[model samples]
Target chain A: MTATLTRQAPQHAPDAAATLAASTPSWSRRAKNRAASAAVVAAVALTAVPLALVIWAAVERGSARLDLTLFTHSMRGVVGQGGGLLHALTGTLIITGATAIISIPLGLAAAIYLTEYAGGNKLAAITRRAVDIMVSIPSIVAGLAAYALFSLILGPGTRSGLAGAVALAMIMIPVVVRSSEEVLRLVPADLREAGLALGSPRWRVIRKIVLPTALPGLTAGAVLGVARVIGETAPLLLVAGFTDAMNYNLADGRMATLPVFIYTQWSSKGLDTAAYDQRAWAGALVLMAVVVVLQLAARALPPQIAKLRRNR
Target chain B: MMAAASAVALVLVGVLVFLAVNGGPAVTAGEGELPAHAKNFLALAGPLAFGSLWVAVIALALASLPAVGVALAATIYAPSPRFGRFLGAVLDLLAAVPSVVFGLWGLMVLAPAVVPGYEWAHAHLGWLPFFSGEPSVTGRTVLTAGMVVAVMILPIMAAICRESFALTPPALIEAAYALGATRWEMVRAAVLPVARSGIVAGGMLGLGRALGETMAVAMVLSATPSLISFNVISAENPSTIAAFIASTFPESTGAEVSALIGLGLVLFAISLVVSLVGRRIAKQGGLR
Candidate 1:
């Protein structure tokens, strides 16, 4: 490097020029640098291309039908041009709520066990591997497992919103456990030891000191877990039989969900194809909005809360 | 705690046992109007498995190239920290978008938009096996599904890559500059080498996702269980196993349900191999 710089130095006055080593970059090198920077920028642009395209398409196509009817009426009667995803929106809320109920408790318990109790034991080892495997299990396979279990229990063919919730819970469990485990591990051992030194029970120490400290993180993990599976289609399609009519009861009857609604509306479009397609697009738009909000909240809210606490 | 751990472990065992017990009959599944040369479960599963792996590999190639660039642009080439933050936000939103929406966009918009290119390739490069067949009139093909999966998995790959690149030691970067290296040269010496395992790990994560993705692929390729072809743009394209199950399981009755379960079993096995191998590599790379 020095040799090239010295060679490129000016030599007009040989006596005074002791190989002044400040060398100007070649034009080719500068051009290459500029081109490389541009290429990197272009690559980032390409990464953004899909998000831009998907949003643009959804907004342009679904905008006409994106109205309040999405939450007002079901798609039971109206067919030609006016129908809403009332059942779907409600179904999404119900099933996702149930999924959270089942998953958060189980996942939190497992995470607590792994981090607070289990210290490289056999059951912990098995659970860790299971969680890892669960993370990779395909959504459809998870759906099928729920399907098989339900079939074995409730006759040959049974589909319910509850079953769908079970399927989603299976998918959400690993996510919840993983994130919660990380948060739990971050709790200072000193706090737990301090609690023990104060003559408190282990469970009391955990519930009083540890859980409160980790509550914000746990909420973020659980909310993110819900967001992750809220738009799931394949699993719900298998377990939650779709219906256009309102079926509020998730115990036994079929339930509609946003993703499956979009799928059904688009694939089973009747004579008024444009109308069905429009409804599907509308459904997609709403689902995207909900998911985007949840995701942003989970990632964005925790830091701000921490900042506020620090300021206070 | 013990109960919770046992519950998870039980579910894992149960899924495997259920698939195994129910799926055994799939091997000799001959009750339906079996397509010629597809008398058994292995034959039935061949095309779907091939399609699954083939589409995933294509998506891996397509997403990884741009993902590396995104990482570089964010960490090294960003003109400002704000640019990197905005880029990260955009990617998080991209990941937040569900796969079904991607499917809708791919089928409704991307496929049609690219039909002309598919036709051009078919007409011009017909001698090549990939473009040898007639273009799909509706534009739902393996390649289209691959493109959709690529877009769906891109955010994950890029995020992982960015995280890996961010961990490169500052001293290493300064040394490259001290040696009078150009910015690109510094990256080549200090960044890429350190992040190579991470890049591979990120690619593998995306691969695992693409392999398992159902809705995007299903919504694009109208399932053709019997046909097997490599012509990516043709009307006839191999469909992934997940797509096959999603299409078939809903309406299946009698023995066909068992066959579908067998397909799920095959998928579970495939995913098991992929997940284990991927997790090992990712651990080596040391970034999620």
Candidate 2:
């Protein structure tokens, strides 16, 4: 009778208890997971709130105060009409253009050599390691390095737009080289082999085949590099001294870039803090807009480049 | 070929030469305005760099939790495909936003918004060292700086973790499911263990960026504080090496400027070592 009772109990009570225990762990786990999820959602919300507030502030303050004089006239000590940032804008474009010119060819060549020609040799590996080191060097160090070199050549107290561009170019090279190499390596060996099989030389195969296929990725890297250098403030401040009126010549006296201008406006505490603050915000917005444009351009590249590649 | 290599070599030489000539003499001497009655280099010890790095570490660690969470949720739960895509794009755009803009936002928006909360914390939690202080002049404090740094680093960390989750071999996930393992069980047992390394790597990179960033820190922090005071709401300005460089380079005189440059060098060396180590760990599949 005892055995019979035990068997009956095993079938009913044991099954229920086992089920409850098995399900218990999951229920508790579910509760923990929900809490974790809520915490993350809260954190992300926290991050986003401040960012949204900033954009709102910029729009509110900017619209209320921005005018043509901010863009057209130089800061002429007028009550409200400190002319345009025309000079600053010009200085920024010219200096950045110079940086691109200096960095792109050198970086692209370095990338091509590393990815296509070196075949992962010891030398290539060392070069890659050096590039990695260079990437982490602070922007200010690059500026100081540039300042060191340019000051020796031009004598003490020599700060020029060219000096800043050169400093920026140093920073730009490692980024471009690393990104371009990665993108170029992503082009399958088959494409290159196919080109070589046609009796094309290695250089020709690279130019005619690999480069075209990887153009979109390479362009994206370049866009990122451009964005990185354009926003750099410390290096520019160290190398390019500020000027009220923008000088277009990179090799000559003070040229004002947007970053430096913003720094000066914020730090100098000149009369009319509002105007200076507005200019700074406007400058930042313009810089961000440029980055957005570059990203859009980068995103647009694959389709256009793919079509071109196919035609070739 | 030799000429090309030499040209590259020349650029490197120029860089070294320039820094030496302009920055050498200054490093050997005391730079910046020294505190009165402070005699030696050791006396120059202020809480500035310590404060900056402390804030950075705290912020990144705090920020990483949410970042990893979102990545996990988006990956494991299979959030609606559209929502996933939207969040991914938004995060990427956030990553692309410049640091200076983040600083500007902190100054104009976050500072004012947090003032009331800061006051409340000071009123209630005044005994706690972290919350004890007169509210800052502009509400720009260690907390605001940390938040900005956290925001700047979040997208990269999230992306790294998300990729790690994606790469969790489907076969393992399937096997866990077959054993009647729930979604959470499978993730805990199979997914996270496989992806731990990637997450750490992502976190390290974020930390490195936080440490080296100049503009945002300069714009957001009160640059006047010279000590390692932990009070986030202190009226005193806290300074970091990067901010110190940006704000003082133009106006510094004699040894003061050189010392700042030395600090810049130190900052550079720190970032370099971090990146190299981070890269190795990343290669080993340790960090996301």
lDDT score of residue A185 within candidate 2: 72
TM score of chain A per candidate: 0.89, 0.86
Clashes per prediction? 0, 21
Chain B, model 1, TM-score against the native?
0.93
Instruction: Give chain B TM-scores in order.
Output: 0.93, 0.85
Candidate 2 residue lDDT tens string, A249-286: 88998888877766766666567777777777777666
> Considering every candidate listed, which one attains the maximal TM-score?
1
**TM-score of each model, in listed order:** 0.93, 0.88
| Fnat by candidate, in order | 0.66, 0.36
Q: Write model 1 residue lDDT over A18-50, tens digit each, in one string.
A: 433454456787788788888887888788887
- Candidate 1: segments with Cα more than 4 A from true spot: A1-29, A304-312, B31-37
Off by over 4 Å in 2: A1-26, A76-82, A303-312, B1-22, B30-46, B78-82, B286-288
Kindly list the per-residue Cα lDDT of model 2 for residues B3-90, writing each as its tens digit. 3223443555565555666655644454344322224333433454576577778778777887787687667764687666666766
